[model samples]
Structures are given as structure tokens and as C-alpha cells.
Target: MYPRVILKETLYKKSQQKRRTSPCNYKERIFMLNTQDLTYFEHRPRKRPTQKGCIELSHIKCVEIVRSDAPIPCDYKYPFQIAHDSYYLYVFAPDNDCRLKWVRALKEATQCNNLFMKYHPNFWGEGKWRCCHQTDKLATGCSEYYPNGAKPLPPTPDPKCRFLDLEERIVVALRNFHPEEDTDLPLHKDEEYVVVDSSEPNWWTVRDKNGNVGSVPCIYVAEKISNDIEKFEWYNKDMTRTEAEELLMRENKDGGFMVRDSRHAGVYTVSIFTRASCIYRSDGEKYPLVKHYQIKETEGENIKYYLAEKYVFSSIPELIRYHQHNSAGLITRLRHCVSRNVQNSSRIKELSSEKWEIHPDELILSEELGSGQFGLVWKGYWHEQQVAVKTVREGFMSEEEFKEEAHIMMKLSHTKLVQLYGVVTQRSPMYLVFEFMENGCLTDFLRDKKGCLSQEVLQGMCLDVSEGMAYLESSNFIHRDLAARNCLVSNDHVVKISDFGMTRFVLDDQYTSSYGTKFPVRWSSPEVIRFGKYSSKSDVWSFGVFMWEVYSEGRVPYDNRSNSEVVEALNAKLRLLLRPRLCPQSVYDLMQWSWKEKPEDRPSFALLLHKLACLHQDP
Candidate 1:
């Protein structure tokens, strides 16, 4: 029987990338998606289309937007990716509607097959995965993926963003508001005004085109974004290097870029992506480099800004405009502008803003996930997804402590870390909402799946925790309590570090009378055991114990010893965790390295991360 046609269109496809090569260029192809298979053919005008490839629907696992800011080389700007077997096929559509139509059709057609639970939201470029920076092509996805393509509850709407009033420096009065007092500005509908000061929560200081200035209600004016620097999609005032790469890679456009403020005051930085770089990673993939050029200015009467130094322009905008059309000594020309909205930056902002104040009514607590020293954890459903709800026990933490930890959690975001969904602060007992983990704690997971799991999986679990710790170390933060029980396992078996905020809470059994604070004796480093010292190295020592738990299939460190006894063993530097049964020699060696008596001698979590990434189970 002939294949039933579902959708067919000519599109731009990213040619397949081979190992150690620069990013492949885009080529026009005629794509046809049908019941049995999806195929693409080389399209040439006035000639028969030559079939290029075919993918069985069963082998297809993921179909989603290639959220990227890299400039598209093709006329069709909107891009999507297909993950089939071991390959990823990226294609572009004329517009967002066309892109979504194809994505939805493909998803509906392949609903019955095995699909990924998590997928990288950005493209794999240079030598690493853009979103997570994982080098392996088959690395576990960093973002949750939905088979039904469900989106998170739309972040509570911002009243300030209504009718295009979103971040506009200049706005038009929506309707007439006559001045009631001399201080108030009289507004006329559709009359233009520049917002001079918006520091007042509800009011703004504005200057009319005629230079008349006074206070006005923020609600009376709406943004007219057709002109202005903030109006340009490329301008991102708060972007950092990491944020810039995330934005550009999410766009998946080769020349995607943004103009952000430099670290220095009064200077702008142009951050752009180039598919190929001069350097290559250990994986032999050409490093996909995100290049940031500080817009430099000449010391002259007619000041000019330049990125290449040789290519100077009259103004910053003129320089940007010139570089858009010319590579001119840089890696790539700035081809497409990706705004922060595409980055969902506002949602990131909201995590720390008033929007973080989740209504107590929205949460529906069901089965208990676990009970801990801090409080009870319940498996709950919010906005159609399972979540873990942690209730802060009364007297467990002070209002000051809770606020401090909440602030820390809000700042931490990583694939290996359990995400803090939101917090409930209005009620008696404070609550923290987190992303749900299906397999519970790593301690329990290793216990249950002990013999069934391979050495690779065990190592991966360690890698996950190490990655999280590495991030903590880099952030100048410390996870004082790092242990198997403090990590959670997702449904796909990806491990994530959790309960990081619980280090402040006192665990009854883990407390030492001399220390005046509670820290798990078995996992505690020598310094922590003696001086109650907690640093990233101390966390690394704890990580050694955690690794021992993983390879030993959840066997407790110092299982036979008491807290006092374990402290003595650590204090003397005579005893350390023994190699778990069947643990790789290299891994065990690294574990020992992490447990060095001197904190300075212990390898940093960042170094440990590199060591773990380099290891493989003996063939």
C-alpha cells in the first residue's frame, strides 16, 4: 500500500555533521512525513527530486524546536530537530506557525513509539551540547521532555507588560489622563513620551516630545517598540557570557548574537556564535565557540565604535549594522537577533521576583515522597506535572535562615541539580516546591537496583552529583552535606543533587557535642570532623563517601561504626572509605584523591568532574 501522506514541504536541512568537522551547512530539501516513514529528498527546480534519506517512524524518538539564537543561513528562519536512532536532523520552516504544524503532525504520528523523557532544549554545536555543555552526543538530556508536548503553566501574567509596555523606554499614552495636580503630567491618547524614571512602583517620570516632564501613572502609557535600543531584539542589558551562549545556542542559528553590556561600565559587548572554532575538544569535535567582542571606541573628536578595530563606525548602532552584513575579521557576521523573551529570561527573573510567591491554593499534596529531619516531603501535582513539596517544620529553621536558603536555591540552576519550582511563604509552616524525582533518593535507588545496574550507570550517577558539586564550587557556594541520600534520581535514572538547603538543619544522630553543630560523621572530612570546617573540599570528601555508596550499592559508609568512632577514624587520617566491590580502579583512586586529609590537597569538584568525565569502565 502507498504511504498515506501527512505533510510535505520544501525546507532547509542542516547537512549531517561528521566527527571532528565544522558544523555542516544547510541545503534545501523536499521533506515528506507519512504514516510508515519520514523522508527528505534533494530538491532541484525543473528536475526530479533525488531521494537522500529515510527514517522509520519507530526509530524516531524526539521532535521539537531547536531553541537557538544562531543566525539561520536559509530563508526559512524557524528551526526544529528530529532525533532518530543515533542521528539528529535539523530543518527550518518559513515561520513559527509552519514549524509548529510540522512538529505537531510529526509528534501525533509517532506517539506510540519510545520517546525521550528529557532532551536538550538547544542544539549540540561545536564540541558540546549548547544547553548543558555536555560533550557526548548521547549525553542525557538536560531539560524535561513531554511526549504530549505540554508546557509549564504560563508564568503569572505581568501587569506591566500589557499592550506592548514591556521594557519600552518610550511609550504612547493609551488614553487621556488629565493632570489633577501640578506634579502630575497630563496625558493625551496616542501621544508619545519618553520614560525618564520608573523607580516608583506604580508611577513613572516621563518627558513628552515637547520636553515637558512630570509624574504619570505607569498604566496610562503603552510601549511603541518600533524604534529604540531596547526595542531591538539583540539588546540584552543583563546578559552574561553564560547567558549569551545559552541564548545563541538555543536559537541554533550559526551567526545568532546579542548586544549586551560589558563587565566594564559604559561599554557594550557583542556576543556571537561561530559554528567552527580554531580549537577542538577531547572528543575531536570542533569547539563551537561563542565569541564576545567588546565594542571599542577610538580616542578622537569624531568618536567611532568598532569590533574588529579596523572596521570602525560613527556609532555603536552603525558598527552593529555594519557587522551584520560583514564578517570583517570576526568569526561570523551577526545575522539574526535573539531577544531575551526567546530565552524565557523573564521566567528566570520571576523565580526571584514576586512571581515566586506561589499561591498556597495551587498545590495539591498527595502521597508522601519522604519524611526527613527538615520536614515531610509529599508528591504533589501542580499545573499537570508531578512535583515534590517540602514543608519546613516549625522550629527547624528561623525566618532568617529560611529566607537565606530560599535566596540561594533561587540562584542555583543546573541540569544535575533538583530545581526549586517555587516557594509557599504566606502560611504558618513554610513550604518549598521542587521538581519531582520518580526513583526517590540515590541511597534508596542504589539499594533497590544494586545488582541490575551496570558499572557505567553507577559512574554516571557519580558524574551527575559531581557536576552539581562542580557548579556549587564555581558559584562560590558550598554543599556542606553531600551524600547519596541527599541526591535524587529522576524517572530516566538521571541523578540530581537535592536537599542542599538542609545543611542548615540539625540532624539529631549526626551531631557531635564538641562541634555544637550537626554534620554526618561518616561523610565528614577530617577538617569538618575536627574544626567543623565546611568548604568545597569538605564537600568533595563527602562526595567520596557518596561514590562509595553508589559503587557499593547503597552500603552505608562506616556502617559498623558510631558517630564518635567515625569521627576518630577521620580525625586520625588513618582510615578512609574502602573501594566498593567491582568499582573501577581509576574511580576508586579519584575517590581517595577527594578524601585527602588536607582540604587544599583534595582535588576541586571541577577537577573531579574532568577526571570522572575521562573515565570509562574497563573493557
Candidate 2:
């Protein structure tokens, strides 16, 4: 606590003046704070409360020595050294026990590892200073010392301090991850497409906003270049050679013309006037710019424009249509002969300067929120809005596969499901931009409370979950993977489902030969486990198990039994033994209704929703 440091104007007494070393260098004494002074302040009593303060004492320490070889080098001992008026506090303790103790404290106070103690005049005086753990939230030099200088500051204000808010904002961008917005691709004008670049599987050379070069997923790139191109052709097959020449003359009044062999395919190979002259179009009709250049004999390679060769199967009318399609600039035909491997490596090793565009602040990584198997999710700001960015390991998936998955997710819109705001598929591991959930997953909360969710609360949760499933079922969607971890609970106990990565579009055929069980095996319906098929009814079966989880206070279902035991019990059609203390007959009745053998016999989600709702009404 800072005491009233009213610097009173009093002539120095004889003893105090004598102790001050009179005629000392006008260079003011740099009152270096030491360990003893820090300890004394902690134990001292004062007239007025210290203003969250610390004190420093000078000229009491041992003389400074330059040790050439004192068995340990200073630099080696201190990777980060503090030089505050010659009194250094090594933030990193060298000993294992002490270091671990300090590390734990720092992790609790602030997760950031790059903690730098700064001197702010308002918080600390000219010479004396105190500890303020730097955090990503507050600005640098913002003191962590509490208003009362309490040893351990009170927990950060919640629900903001719920680690989930920070964790949810992290997103990882992988190679081949593309910006879904603001870039043009070859798609219909009305179609929504993410900006994607097919770069190397591992495009390491990255240049961030600060011009600092580092290795990162290609999806982090904000912008890239689009090369415009066009081809030319003529289609009037009925016209005589003279008539064709006349038509060519009329069209070529502007600038360029060229032509080549049109002898093989049904359509003739011809050239005409275009953007740069040598645009190729399937030949038959006269090109407008043909008159720009006189026709002359040219070698194979020397031919600037080569049109399709005319053949018996080729129709002249079709060739005319092809010419128009090329002319419209709406179609861009990519040739297989053009090697992406060769061009990507030799021509543009890194992204072009012109192609580089700014990503919404959210797209740009701010700080490493955390790391996981997929990759790292960084906390970032997009358009001044907060978002979590998940970047995945490079080459984890194909670009096409990632894009297909993203397409499915983007098309889906449900309040019960977590929304997919943006996606990048140009990178190897794909990125999903989602609205950050303030409350952490229900799993964390359950684990924290020793899995002791009250019976009433657990029943209410069951209703929320069923309602969410009802919505999904109405949309003809199956979560495909539903578990306690996937179910998110807000601080206020509202349940919402998330993580549709494994979700698939349910078709009329209903059954898939892909997996024996489309849903999680542990929570799977008996039919799913035995016959390898799942429908909305199967989801109801899983919901029954999820209810068991909540009712049991999150005790692992069938935990004490082996996999074989579970399989055997289910095969014998055994009902799960519910804890009577926690679950009432109503709970048992609802679960039994859902866990019926046949899908047709099982109650619909709407019916289940009604029964669960009635439970709440009963209370």
C-alpha cells in the first residue's frame, strides 16, 4: 500500500545532512531498491497508507565487481536481467524448486511469458519501484499491484476471466488456408467463394504486418494477385473464304491479328484481334482483328495463335458457341500442360507483393492463445472485433477436401449450432472462424465441480440438449458426433451444441457403408454399434447417454467395465443401472423411451422435447 509521500520542505538536520554525503555529485542519487528494502517495506507500519508503493535504499549494498571467471557467467545465469539502478532482480530463478514456485505464481497472475517490469512515474517514484506482472489484457507499464498492494490480487472479473473466452478466440491458419472473403476466384458472380491460393503444401516463408519474416501456414496471407486473360475465336463456318476475309477485315480495324494450324479437329485453327493479339479461338469464322496482320506461312512454334483443328465429329455451330464463351471473359479454361509445380516453385516462391492484401485484424494473429494437436489457435482482432483463429498443421488435409467441408459448414445456419463466420482453405490444415463463446465448454465446468450437477439442473440441461437436437433433426442434419465435450454450457447454464467437424448431410438413403457407427461408439445407439447405421433416432439414443452423463454428475459411462463388457451388456439388451439417488422415475422413463431397440419405436425428438419440458413444468 502506498503511504502519503508528502515531500515536506525541511532543512536537512545535522545528522541527516551528514549521512547524505554533502557535496556529492549533483547527479541525483539513484536510490537502488534492494532485496532487504523490499522485505522491510512489506513488514513496515506507516502513518498513512502507501499509495500501492515500494521503497528503495541506496549506498548500502556491496561494491560492484566485474567477475571474469566466478565459475558462472552473469549472462548465462540471466538470459533476462533487470538493471534498475544497479539492483537487478532476475525474474527467472536459477534453482529448480524456487524457479518452479515463481513460475506457478506468474502463470496464475498472468499467462504471458514475456513479462517485463517497467517504471511508471505514477505507480512508482523516481528511484523506487514495485512488481507489476505484465499481461496481454492491460497495457505495458500498467501496474499489476492491487490498489491495496495485496500480496495476491483478487481474481479477474468474470465471466470475462473464464479462460474459455481467451481460448475460444484462438484460431489456427494452415497452408492452403485461403481468405473466404474479398478475393476473386473463378466462380459465378453471385456465388460466394473464399479467396484461395494453391501454394506449396508447406509455404513457410511468411511476411507479417511488421515486415517480419517467419514461417507460418499459407492461410495467414491476406491478399494475392489475379492475372486477367482472354482468348479469341471465330465461328461463321457457312461463309466462303472471301466472305470470311471480308468479315475479318471488318473486325480487325483496331490493332492485332495472328493464326496457326486448324487442319485436324472439326473446327479450324484461326487467329483474330484480341487484347494482346495472339488470343486463340476454335477456327471457322473470321476474327475481327484478323486484318491487323497479313496471313503468312509460319513454323509450328512461331505460330502465335493456334485454333482447334477441324474434324468430322466437330460441328461448326458448336465452334461458334465456343468462340462466344471465350469472348465473354466469364470462362477461364486452365490447361493441364501448365505445371503448377514448376510455376509455383520457380516463378513465385513467395506471394507476390501486389497480391498481398490486408486481412481483417481477426485474420492476423495477435497472440498465441494456446496450442493443440491440430495446430495453434491465436487470439486476434478482425475489423476491431475479437475472434479466435485456429491454424492447423501444414499438409494435414488436401485443399479440395478442406474447401468441400467448409462449403457444407458455410451453408448451414442454426441457432442451436455454433456459426461458422469465415474459413480459409488455401493452407494445408484448414481454419474455421467462429464467433467466440464466452462460456467455456460444459466439460470444464463439470470437471471443476467434481461432476456434481444437481438433479434439477441436470434435467433442465437434458431439455436444452434435446431442443437443440430437435432443431438439427428438423433441418435434416445429424451431429454425427455428440458428446459431453461437444455440448457447450454458458455461465448461466444455457446449453448449446458445437463442433460440427464430423457432421454430415443426411440423405434420403439414410444409411452409409462408411463407418460401422456414424456416431461416437461410447454413446452410440445399439443399432449403430451392431448394424453400423444411424439416423435422427440414433441421435436420440446418444442423447439418452448424454442424459446419463449429466445425471451421474459426469461419471464416465460404463467406466468400470471393459469394452467387451459394454458390448456384451448392449448385445443382451441390458438397461443401464441408474443411480436412484440422482435420477427419478421420470428420468428413467424418458431414457427408456429413447433407448428402444428399433428406430421406429423410439420417440421423435419433438416428443422427447415435450416430455423433458413437462419435467421442468412439474418442478
Candidate 3:
């Protein structure tokens, strides 16, 4: 393969040496790309081409279309660059298609080489970079560089070791999903399956337990290492330390035990209730203490576990069997295994394929919670759990319209954002099921609490909303209707961002509204109110006013001002709301930072979250 030709073309070329002192004149050249090397020859009229330079393909680190605005003194103006061995060679083509063809072919030819993770899109010219204006020639690229320009394939499984690595290779379904198309495979919650191919980021080809193979969404399943214990009576996988203690205390039974996942990932702890009848508190009540023991694992060829080093068992069940008959080193022998579902508050699987789109007949409505811009909000029940239902008022929006909102809502999941359980779109008057917020909307909660709220509480609300907004920003979602009225308050006073009325998932972080698209004028950034431009940073501007609402005890921004007046005020590039009375200067400064005139000047939601978190640590 030494001299096998891959591509042969005549093109205009610039100096191969990247140094500022190198020759700058453009000249015609005959370029030949072979399996082993790329060789360019000096153009000679009706004579043998004289070889000018040769570069091994292995030396090529980058091949891409260069972003440039320099005057081209050649017939071909479409330029692409090849970065090899600390130097760049610019080759000009007659058209963009020709430039892209060379760039793509070169990229494919060098796909397997060790490559750079970052690159400057603009040309590094005149002893400076055009993209970021860095003086250093070897400075890190201002943009992310994706090697191979494609999703990586999962390592192929070796036939001999496939079954031997079952625990690590097999993924168990977290929820049920019926096939929506020919490509999709039906998934049953908790069933294990083997991944056949994971070349697609969201969808993976998998083989189920019954040998049924098909494509499934990668998010629907996860690898569960110790799946054998999932069906055990004593296992409760999703409870916290406090939750375990509460469960054991409620039972009021000594020696009652439950094995739960530890706070530290991939670890387990055993909690047991042991009581001393004579040990009484000063208030004359018997004391109950739940002893927690971390199950220690020993490193060896075969993994083993034990509460005490002396009595080790290969499995947790075996250890439970031993401790059941004898105390050994425990405070008491394990007895009366506590189940998770005894109380209705047990953890519900967050998302599953079958749970997202609910049948309207299954929802049970009781009392009216409230009403909003979309429709009437009602307290509803589904799967025996209380949820808030937001109905789409007839004529307000159709099933197709509501489905777009639901699709965006389903992809998002964060503690601070109001959780969307599912939707009912198959019938008339489509509705959405969301986690109920007992304390109601944030605006109402702020008004009701007013002077009774502490500084910590106000700050906590800001942090919670910022955290949710940060998640949305990272997820490339812009909550165009972000406001205090749109946020909800949980029973524990946890503030969660809600009402994604104008939400859009943008890959490029920018979205333009249609001619008649509606948005909150009072809370929108300048670009949005004027040009109808929206981005995550635009959402940050809305959050500044949201923070103002919390600090001002729910006072509306530009009180008594009309929507047109608010737009005019934003157009004038002035603050719409002043600092709240008794608000911290540092916090007020951050609010102003979020309300910058340009969206790019405003901080990201992630950065806002950091600033608020830092303020949380403030006195």
C-alpha cells in the first residue's frame, strides 16, 4: 500500500510552514494523496512534476475547513487547512462543495489517529488567532473538537467472555415501553437485557432475556450489577438513612432489619432496630436506636461480604440466614424483614416507557387546585398517587400543540423543576400530570409568608429555582416563561420551577419566535422583547426578576406598568425593578448581572447557580 493513490487533484496552495516568517505567496500545485503519505509537487508546464514536499498521513493531527476572511489572490477561493506536525497547509478549492469534499475525505482517512480535543475554527494568522485573539500560536482551541465527528461504538463483546461478564454487560429495564415503531422493542420494567449495539446515543440495540432483539431507548435501561437481590424480601433499594430509621421506628419491632443502598454509590448498608426495654428517656419514653452496619467486602478472586470479619458469606442472603439464627457480632439477630411499600410514600420509579402517556379514564379528580393561563389545575390521582393535573382548555391548544409541550417536558428531570409524570393526549381536552406542590405557586407562597420569611428561606428559594434553571440551561432548554408565578412550592417549602408554556429545546442555544408567538413581555430579555430572539441566557434575565419577586415578598416587577411600557423600558436598556428593601447588596448585584442588556453578557444558569450557592454559605 506504499504508493496506492487515494486522491489526485490540482489546487492553489499557501506556505506549508506556519511561522510568520514563512513565504506568504499563493502558488498552483499538483497534490496527490496516497495510502502512506500526502505529496505535493511544483506545477511544471508539459514536463515532469518536481516533488516539493511529502508528509506522512500519520503526522496529520487535524483536517478541517478554516474560518477565514483574508483576501485570496488565487483562482480558488474556498480554503481548507491540514494541520500536521505543528504547521498548517492551506489549500484553496474552486467552490465550497469542493472544499467540503476534500475536508471530509481527509477526515475519514485520518479517523483512527491520536487527535486534538480542541481547535481554532478561524485561521491562526499574523502572529495572532482570529477566533479568540490569543497571541500564543499553540494556545488551546476556543472551540470543542469532536474526533471522528460521530458517536463512538460500544466495544464489541467477545464470544468466549460474553456470559462470563454478564453482571457488567447486561442492562435491566427501569420501566415498561411498548413499541411505537418497527425499530422499537417492547420493554418490561425490571427485566434484564444484553446490549447488542450502542452506536446511537439515545437508542441502543439490545437482546432481551427471552432472546427477543430490537432497538430501545438507552435511557430506559441501566446496568444493575447485583440484580439477584432485587427480588429479595429484605431489600429496599431507594430509601435514605432517615427513611430507613423512620420505617423501622414505625414498626416498633426489635431486631427488624432492612438492607438498603448506601449514600456512597455502589455500596450497601444493613439497618437493624434493637431496643432496650429498661433504657428510658427523661420524658419517660423507651429509647429506640437503629444500628446501621456497612456490609464490608473483601478483595479476592471471588468477592465475599460480612458484617464481621470472622463470619463471612458469599451473598447477603447467606449472611442474613446466619444472623437470623444467631446474633454473631450484631446487636440482635435479623428478624421481621421490613418491606418498602408498607407506607404509600415509597419511592416511585422516576420514569418508565408505559407511564409517560396515561389513559384519561385512569385519572381521578377531586377538588380544584387552581387555574392558570393554560387551563384549570385540579388535584388528581393516578396509580394511587396524588398528582396535579393541568388540562388544556378547549380551543386554547389542540392535541398536536399540547404534544410539543409534553415532548419537551418529558426529556427534563431535576429535583428543583416540577416533575412531569405523563400526559393524556389521545382524547379530547388533553391534560398533563405533574408532581403536586402542596404549598402552591411561588408567588402566592411569597405573599402569604411575607414578613414571616427569614433571609435563609428567601435565599433557599433563589438557589432552588436557579438549580432547576441551571439544569434546563445545561439541557439546552429555554424556559421562555420563567417567572415567580410559574414556579411551584412543595409541601416542605422546596421551590420548583414550573409551567414550561414557552419552552423550546434548542441544539444551538438560540431560538426565534414565530410572528404571533406569545411571551411574557415583563420578564423577557431585550433581544426577546425586540427581535424575538431567545436563549438560555435570556432565561437568566427572567430569573433575575424571579429572584426580585422572592426578595420583594411577591411584588410584581414595574408594578402597575403596562406590557408596552415594560417593553419600552427594556428597549431603553434600563432596570425594570429596583432593589428590594432590606435585600443584601451582593444579592442585588447578582440580580443586576443577570439582567444585562446583551444575552451573551449575562451569566449562564450554571454560573448563576454557583454564585447563589456561594451566597448560601454567606452569613
Highest-TM-score candidate: 1
* Runs of candidate 2 exceeding 4 Å displacement: 1-361, 364-380, 426-429, 515-519
The RMSD of every model to the true structure, in order and in angstroms, is 21.2, 24.9, 23.7
lDDT of 2 by residue, 1-619 (tens): 5532322111111111121111110111111123223211112255532232233423222111111101121112211122234333222233334333332332333322233343221211112222222332123443232211132212232242222122112122212332111111112211112322222222223323333322333223322212111132222333344544454454332221222223343324333433223345587543333322222223454332223332111223223323322221211111011111122112111221212222343376678755633567666666766666666565443332344345456545433456566765444345666655555566665667654567778777787777677766755567666777777666577677776655555433143322111245678778777866657888888888787777766677788877778878888887676653578888888888888888899987777776676666464
Measured against the true structure, the TM-scores of the candidates, in listed sequence, are 0.47, 0.42, 0.46
Q: In what order do the candidates fall by lDDT, top score first?
A: 3, 1, 2
Minimum summed lDDT over a 10-residue window in model 3 is located at 344-353
Best by lDDT: 3
- Superposition error at 336 for model 3 (Å): 58
The lDDT per prediction is 0.73, 0.44, 0.74
TM-score of candidate 3 against the unseen true structure: 0.46
Which lDDT value does model 2 have at 77?
23
Candidate 2 steric clashes:
47
Q: For candidate 3, write residues 284-326 as lDDT tens digits.
A: 8878788899988899887888998977766676666556544
Alpha-carbon RMSD, candidate 1: 21.2
1 or 3, which is superior by TM-score?
1
Question: Which runs of model 3 end up more than 4 angstroms from their true locations?
Answer: 1-354
